[model samples]
Target chain A: MRTCLIVDDSRVVRTVARRILEELQFSSREAGDGQAALAACQEEIPDFVLLDWNMPVMNGLDFLRALRQLPSVRQPIVIFCTTENDINHIQQAIEAGADEYIMKPFASDVLQAKLVQVGLL
Target chain B: MQAADFQFLSALIKERSGIALSSDKTYLLENRLGPLAAQRRLNDIAGLVAQMRSVRDEELIRDVVEAMTTNESLFFRDGKPFELLRTVILPRIVAARPKERPLRIWSAACSSGQEAYSIAITLLEEEGLLAGRPVEIVATDIATSMLIKAKAGVYSQFEVQRGLPIRLLLKYFAQKGTNWEIAPRLRSMVSFRQHNMLGECAGLGRFDIVFCRNVLIYFDEPTKKGVIERIAQVLAPDGVLLLGAVETIIGLSTRLEIVPGAAGIYRPVGSGPRAAVA
Candidate 1:
């Protein structure tokens, strides 16, 4: 089965995302912050990463930059899920190697659509 | 609501609009019309139905029909058709059309104008391919309320987030309070009109492409065939018709045929590449 690493500071957000990802037929792992996510990636790279914008230790943009540099043959597709709706944040996420950007408080269909857009689901 | 009331309202809706509600849509009637009834100071669905039966209030009838018609839409609702337009359809039309005659597109049943505006955005992005040729988009719906909203070009935060990418949203829309309003340039490209699919299409003129997506499913078989036949009449010799992903022309019309390798895309019969452009 395809796996995903969901990195978010909030446990509630991580739980919700996990449930939605499972419904989409993906096995998932959770990380509280970006630093932990990096460690998780080092342990075993996932097929996809649902990263948050703001978190302690390392932010999503920084993790994305670091994640891209990891000398792995198979790179995980990063999707930035956050409350940042502005163009600048989106542009920054794209430049930092995020495959897709989705706004917060989205329904499952919205997330599913983004996954489909990135050819992940 | 009583079964008779449900029967009356559903029949009334079908008569006015081509939308055919099934027996299982009782909750739909109550859910949609309940608020409408409250707004109009009617006691309940019963009062609403009684009012319609006794009085010949065209405005009330129109409101009921509009309420029942689903207005759920998002920008670039399905991404595939827009991609097809950008790559395959527009290029062909632009190559064949005369310089003086602008390429025209019709967004039939364009609820709140997303489909029409999406088409406009596609044209704007392909400015290089268009080579300075003019393009016009006519967006029409049976509901005047939807047409008014479409003309405004304002979308909620949720609506904009559905299928619209951040790049296009940032480029084409300006933030207005919590909602994003489409730029004036994009808004100017489309003209909104109150039109019924069952009515005459001659007034709308010929279209190089027609997007009649997701609306025909609500219609019965005969109504679906009638609508497609009418669209075929107004379509240019090489015009393309894009339906919803699930919609097809099979067993519906002899006037239209599905374009192979392109699901939900259709063209008028005998209007192949060899046919001269009118």
Candidate 2:
């Protein structure tokens, strides 16, 4: 089964994302912040990462930048999920190597479509 | 809400709009028409039916028909068809058509214009696919209210969120308070009009591509066949038709045949092998 690392500070957001990813037939691992997400990545790289923008210890953009530098043959497809909808943020995320980006408060259908667009599902 | 009333309303709606309302749609009728009844000062659906029978209120009938028709749509509702259009169909059409003749697309039953606008965005994003060739999009619907909203090109935040990628949303739309209005460049490429699928389509002229997705499922078998035949008439010999993912033309009309390896894409039958795309 494809594994996903869901990085978010809020437990509610992580739980909701986990449930939706489960329905999409993906096994998920949760990280409270970017620091822990980085640690999880070092231990075992996931097929996909649902990263949040703002968090304590390490922000999403910082984590994405750091994740791209790591020495590995298989890099996870990063999808930046956040409440941020500005063009500057989206451009930065794409520049930082996010395969796709989706706005928060999204439904299951939206997530599935994004996944399909990224060829992760 | 009674059986007889339901039958009468369903029959009336089917006759007027070619939308078949099955028996299980009782709750749908009540849910949609309930507020309409209250607005007209009727107690319930039963009273609404009686009003319809007693007097020939053309406006009231039009309102009821509009209410029952589903206008639910989203940007890039299904990703595959649009992807196919970008990679396979448009390239072939652009290469085949003469530069003097502009490419024409018809979005039949386009609710609030998302499909047509999505098509416009696809073309715009292609950069040099059209080169210097012109393109035109004609979007039509049976509901005047939908056409009005479509022409305005304004969408609520919720409406824009569904099936619309964040990047494209940021690139193509400008924020207006809580809503987003489409760019004028994209708006100008498409023209919105009120049209019924069952009516004559020859007046609209021939189209290189027709998007008639999702609407035909509401029609009965006979109605579906008639609409398809009419579309076949207006479809250019080398044109393509896109239907809903689950919709099929089998057992309906022989004027069109499915394009092998392409789901939901059809071409005019015996139109020569030039219509096929790699």
Top model by DockQ, which number? 1
Quote model 2's TM-score. Answer: 0.94
Give each model's clash number: 0, 0
Candidate 2, position B96, lDDT: 90
Q: Candidate 2 docking: what grade? A: acceptable
Q: Can you tell me which runs of candidate 2 are displaced by over 4 Å? A: B276-278
lDDT, candidates in the order shown? 0.89, 0.91
Model 1 lDDT at residue B255 = 84
Candidate 2 per-residue C-alpha lDDT over B60-137 given as tens digits, one digit per residue, 9 for 90 to 100: 999999998999899988878789889998999988988888899999999999999999999999959888788999
TM-score of each: 0.94, 0.94
